[model samples]
Target: MEWLVLLLIGLVGGTIGSLVGLGGGIIVVPALLFFSTYTVILNDISPQVAVGTSLLVIVFTGLSSTLMYMKHKKVDYKSGFLFFIGSGPGGVVGAYVNSYLKVDSFSVYFGIFVILTSIILMFREKLKRKEKVNHFPFQRVYTDGEGTTYTYGFRPITAVIISFIVGFSSGLFGIGGGSLMVPAMILLFGFPAHVAVATSMFMIFLSSILSSVTHMTMGNIDWELALFLVPGAWVGGQMGAWLNTRLKSKTVIHLFRMVLIIVGFRLIYEGLAQ
Candidate 1:
């Protein structure tokens, strides 16, 4: 019964994650904290296990959504590859250090990430409110209407720098990595909402893979439960892509920011609870 509930939750999480380029952690983590709390074998320890297992799960989730994004011509390979370069190594280093962390330490770390994420996100929203869209970079990206034209002559440099920061954070936190990538791409670099979401998913696919490998090498991955999760993640990814087809990007972005804020407070509460 609990597995059934998690599968349903994974579906919704994947759908929401696909739409927003959030890498699905937004859905999985919260469910572990609140919803999955009702289930057995996942009571108090669910949050920690869920964070790990979800990262392992989203490798497939990101891959599926990434392929869909590619089909739609939403991928920006130049930037995506650059971001992967840094995130991959960072994930390895992060996993190696995971063993040193205690639950209290994780709570504190999560609190810091939540606050930093919220601050950056709040700043981005402020910029959006004050700035003109016409001045945005990458204005005529993706399609040229008559042709499948794409351009990234220099965007990868800035994106790579940002990716380093995002990847480092991901490795440190065990997050899917999009929690930082999506906002960094959009507000910092002015990527189109669709492109940012799509590319972030792709980037996370790499980061998460490396993180999983590192964790697995260190014997941190739980293969039995991870296998149980694959189906749920697959269903979720497809549903998320479908949802993205219908939702507005701004609405999705705003909602994601809200989740960041709530998660930030939740982490802070947990950290202080001890």
Candidate 2:
């Protein structure tokens, strides 16, 4: 029964997360809550443990999903790497704080942020001005390790600020922060959807790695549970990438945020209800 529970949870959560770049937090957190509802082991930890452990699984989730984006050439190495500066350190600090911090203090903001981003993502076309960048936004020429040279329209300051905030959230909430990061890259920085998604996966990778490490430092991660979660996330992430390709961008974007708002409220309600 335990094995079955874990498997189903992984499949359901993994599929949704991979599909939407949700990082499986919506599923994992609630699933952990459910698991604890009837079980002794996982139930014993404070809410902090649950959030920390859920974050730990993302290490594998990012690894598995990022490959699909790379294969498609949707990744923008320059911006992705630049964004790393903020996510990496922020993740470490955030993870450390979560071990002893009260996430509830921040939950309201998290919900609000998610809700707002969802709204913007959904109504993206309404917000866009006619001025589109035909040229890259930065003056520097970047060459990827594979020797693909390109000019980007992205501003580093923007990436740094967003990455820092996103990273802080990643650590604090144990959410991947992609739900916030991906859309921002698209709507604010003018990254293509695929590029945004691909880049966000890698960014999630860095953030999750630091977060997991910090959680483990507190002896918080359940490796046994991660074993159940990671493999399934990989499969789901691929199918998600495929779906992202087929979906109507504007419609999906709008729907994505509405989903976030609903889910965010649902999560907050569930947490408070408990």
Candidate 3:
């Protein structure tokens, strides 16, 4: 019964995550903590174990979502590849640091971070882009499977720095980093919402793989919990990616904001209550 519940949670998390490029960790982590604490487990789960297992599940969710998005030609391979290069080293550093963290103390800090990010995302639509959107040295034109074209400008150095920060935080917190990357791509780099989502998922796939491997080596993961969630995550990932093709860019952003606000508040509450 517990396994079934976890599978259902994964399905919901993956579906929502893939639709907006959040990679399901935001949803999965809280669900894992809740279940392990009051209902699902015979013993309480440590926050580190819950976080570690969440990262493992993201491996499958990211892979499934990336492949599905790639099929639509929505993923910007060059950008994701570049970000992966920076994130790799950062991920290793984050994992090493996380090993020394205390779960209880880290949870409050993590909660505060999530809430702050949520506040930013809430007003993201209202934030004005500078007139110099085209000023970045590196720019690209990409066409999706539907033949819709998009052009965006970015500074390679800035992108690398941001990717490193995102990767480091993601590895430390057992997140996929798409939460940070998606907003940065759209708001800072002027990427189309769909392209940002697809590209972010691809980058997350690479980062999470590295992070998960590190967590495994540190013995942080709960294999049984991850096993229970993977199958559902796979199916939901495909389902959400398919839905993304049909959704409007504004709708996607709105959904993304809504999820962030809800999850952010929930995390904040959990952090304080615990």
* TM-score top scorer: 3
Give the per-residue lDDT of model 1 (tens digit) for 11-88. Answer: 766776677676776566556655533446454643446566777877888888888877777788767877898778
| Top candidate when judged by lDDT against the true structure | 3
Pick out the ten consecutive residues of candidate 2 with the lowest summed lDDT.
127-136
In candidate 2, what are the lDDT values of residues 57-176, reduced to their tens digit? Answer: 776667667777777666667677888898888888877777665545444545665576566555555543213544545533434446765433566787788898888778877778
Task: Estimate TM-scores for all models.
Answer: 0.80, 0.80, 0.89
Sort the predicted structures by TM-score, highest score first.
3, 1, 2
RMSD of each: 4.1, 4.4, 2.5
Model 3, span 1-274: residue lDDT tens:
7878889978977887788787888778777766766674524777677667777888888899999987887888999999888777777778778888665566676676666666655665564433356778878787666677667878998999999988887788777777788888887887877778888888888988888888889888888888889999998889889998996445756665666567666666766776
lDDT of each: 0.67, 0.68, 0.78
Q: Under the 3 Å rule for N, CA and C atoms, how many clashes does model 1 have? A: 1
Off by over 4 Å in 3: 40-42, 125-133, 144-148, 249-274
Q: How accurate is candidate 3 locally (lDDT)?
A: 0.78
